[model samples]
Target: MKRKWDSSDERYFGIGIYRPKTVENVGSLWRTAYVLGASFVFLIDAKYKKKSSDVLKVWARIPLFQFETIEAFIQTVPYSCQLIGVEMDDSATPIQDFFHPDRAIYLLGSENNGLPKSLKSKCQELVILPGEPSLNVAAAGSIVVYDRILKKVNRSLLIQ
Candidate 1:
């Protein structure tokens, strides 16, 4: 049977994984981002093409950027794209009420520590998972990517 994922987006956003400890997780995140129409996937403070995960294969198609630091990566984001942090913080807006930007870079922090305080301070917006304690890095990033695609698709339908 044909799948809905065959669809495309005119303006695709990006997703990122920050210092992920496992190769498998990053590989999974990259695959999800690719399947969901993300324009790119990025790595922060992590070695590029050093792991034997399936990520290298996916990287062949989707552009992946390696940043020396989160600050450096944040600086590279286009002004038109909002840097949204996926973290559970007291000040974070619940994902349900938050407005997914038309162009966004959804950043997921390390799986063990969540987002760093310095990175949190820099994000334009922080979105909380709510109810769940937290999710594994890849799982959380996939949810955010899926949410963006769903909202974008629905918005386009309304305009038509």
Candidate 2:
């Protein structure tokens, strides 16, 4: 039987990078995502080499989708999922203030250049982590995921 989606029901989220520059970062992010309950991980316009940092072999536990272009990635976003872009843009909402959606795909940009205007335009919301100099892409993604988990837990506590 098909079940209807409910906001209070189990929620799922995924995190990914756009044109990621290093294999180690990808592996680290993948490991963290799996540990933090991400339903999946993905890459857009990038490829990753196997890295030892991913000792958990998270790839076997969760799915990783690779898309050659932003459009391709956008097309595959699950229905009712929001695209939350993590960036340092001035207009972005601080991670602490941003209420994560029940279903979301968090997209982080490449380490050096960050997300392009074309891609940022497509994001439903842009969020910024707390920091001055830019953070490593993997680290930024980890923080975002951690924030989401933390907020979700806090909300659940309130409800209980």
Candidate 3:
């Protein structure tokens, strides 16, 4: 399900998985991000270390942004883009109800604890998937990314 990279950056949204601590999750996330046509993935507190020797590997080809702080990550995004924090909060609507943004960032948090309360406060929107107490970080991320892409693709048909 790898996506052919778009020549021009227009219309597609971005996926940001906040602070994943496992390499397995990172690999799983990489595959989904590629399929969803996300511009890049921001990995906060990424656990694996990248040795200089790993430069030419397939993982290196993927866009991975590691930030020291969530504030720094937010700063990197353009103000024009929308940021949605995925978490289980009272105000959050189901992922299906959240509107797909023309330029967006989907934030998936750490496995043990969800997105930090402080970070959640900054999000323009928050979304939740029902019926489960929790989800594996990678699985939750894939669901959100796929759902967003599906909604956008469906919406396009109505415009034509």
Candidate 4:
């Protein structure tokens, strides 16, 4: 990729995975986003070798925004998009039970604490993927993206 921001806005199904540790995981998510056609990525406390470098080569061509906190980032997203938080909660709906909105922003929490309680309050819904408790952050993100894309591609069949 040329590593330049594309004029085209990120697709309708774009995702915003919250603060993640390890560039490797971040890189992997970026790759997934690229495959999923995500418009851009927002990083909080993300370590960068350089603002623009080969390490960020995956996201170079994509629109990448850096923020100090989740609160700030969420403010920037358009109100029209549904902000979803992926977490393990008593009331969390299964990821499969829900339908992906035309404009959705899936929020992936950190590895240790999951999503902050305060932030979770803002999500339109909280979801949990059916699996072992050990699902890594990157894998969780990939699953959400895949699920949404599947629903989106099969919308016609679903209606019938």
Candidate 5:
């Protein structure tokens, strides 16, 4: 039996950053987030940086929320959403092997420090990329988004 197409797999996930150090990286990641079907993009402790790039200029289409702090952000996460921290903790599982939650808020950390302990404590799962535990913050986010899209692109979703 053929399954009907499901947009459900494409729109539930969100991508976020924890005080990203550079505007360019965040901008690039935001553009990729839109391509990967993220419902929206958010920033923790965002510096209220000015926009320059074409991607950064796009706010009307993809909403960008800036949280004053991680605590405030945590409080706002949807009740059904699962927070997935992108980190390299010893307990963290490889990204390739980890199963993405249905409603995921994929969180990337600062370019210099990765995720703060406070934010890490709030996440239900931590994922590390294969071989390289630490990647550029934007790269890490792009990879996660790519993984989610790949997971959603199964036989049923393919065109005949």
Candidate 6:
């Protein structure tokens, strides 16, 4: 589906989780993604269930793509759009230092286990949030989206 933003504003992004184990997390993440202007949300090897946490009924406002496998998801990534992985890994750049791509899709791992190595290797860029012992999947995804929005706003202010 076409995005709400105009063509001149090339920046657009989607957020999704891989093998998410909790419905609440998916609902909360979906709401956050919609509120933060994410172009879309997705699930990899998982299914979403209705939950009360999504007060905005984000399903109606945003698109959610489900892929049976990682390869299937990779096939749908838009041309020229980068796939970014959000995980706590030694090779990942810290969130504060990472630059938000003009067109990107941010993928987060499940609540129990972080991103698998195969998927992590495919990401053009991987960003790690602050703190140890990891964080809730929904919280981490929200932070990534928020950071992207914050940086974009700061960049526009500078250009003006």
Which residue pairs show collisions in model 2?
none
Error of 2 at 4 (Å): 10
Where does model 3 exceed 4 Å of error?
1-9, 50-61
Q: Stretches of candidate 1 above 4 Å error?
A: 1-10, 48-56
Q: What is the model-wide C-alpha lDDT for candidate 6?
A: 0.91
Using lDDT as the measure, name the better of candidate 4 and candidate 6.
Answer: 6
Candidate 6 residue-wise lDDT, 26-109, digit = tens: 888988999899889999999776765566778899998899999999999999999999999999999989999989999999
- Model 3, range 49-143, lDDT digits (tens) per residue? 54434434535555877887888887887867888888888999887678877788888888878799888988899999876788888888898
TM-scores of all predicted structures: 0.87, 0.92, 0.84, 0.82, 0.86, 0.92
Predicted structure 4, TM vs. truth: 0.82
- Cα lDDT tens digits, model 5, 1-160, are 7767665544488898998888888888888888767889999987856475573455766888999987899998898789999988888888778888778999998888889998988999999887665788888899888887776565336743
Instruction: Write candidate 2's Cα lDDT for 1-160 as tens digits.
Output: 6878544586899999999998888888998999999999999998776665566778899988899999999889889999999999999999978999989999999987999999999999999998799998999999999999999989988887
Of the two candidates 4 and 5, the one with more favorable lDDT, higher being better, is 5
lDDT-better candidate, 1 vs 2: 2
Error of 5 at 61 (Å): 1.1
Candidate 2: list runs displaced more than 4 Å: 1-8
The predicted structure with the larger TM-score, 3 or 6, is 6
Summing lDDT over every window of 10 consecutive residues in candidate 1, give the lowest-scoring window: 3-12
What C-alpha root-mean-square deviation, in Å, does candidate 6 show against the real structure? Answer: 3.7
C-alpha RMSD of candidate 3: 5.8
What is the TM-score of candidate 2? Answer: 0.92
- Compose the digit string of candidate 1's lDDT tens values, residues 1-160: 7675524343658888788888778788888888888889998988756355463477777888889887799789896778899998899998888888877888899978888988888789999876777788899899888777778789778877
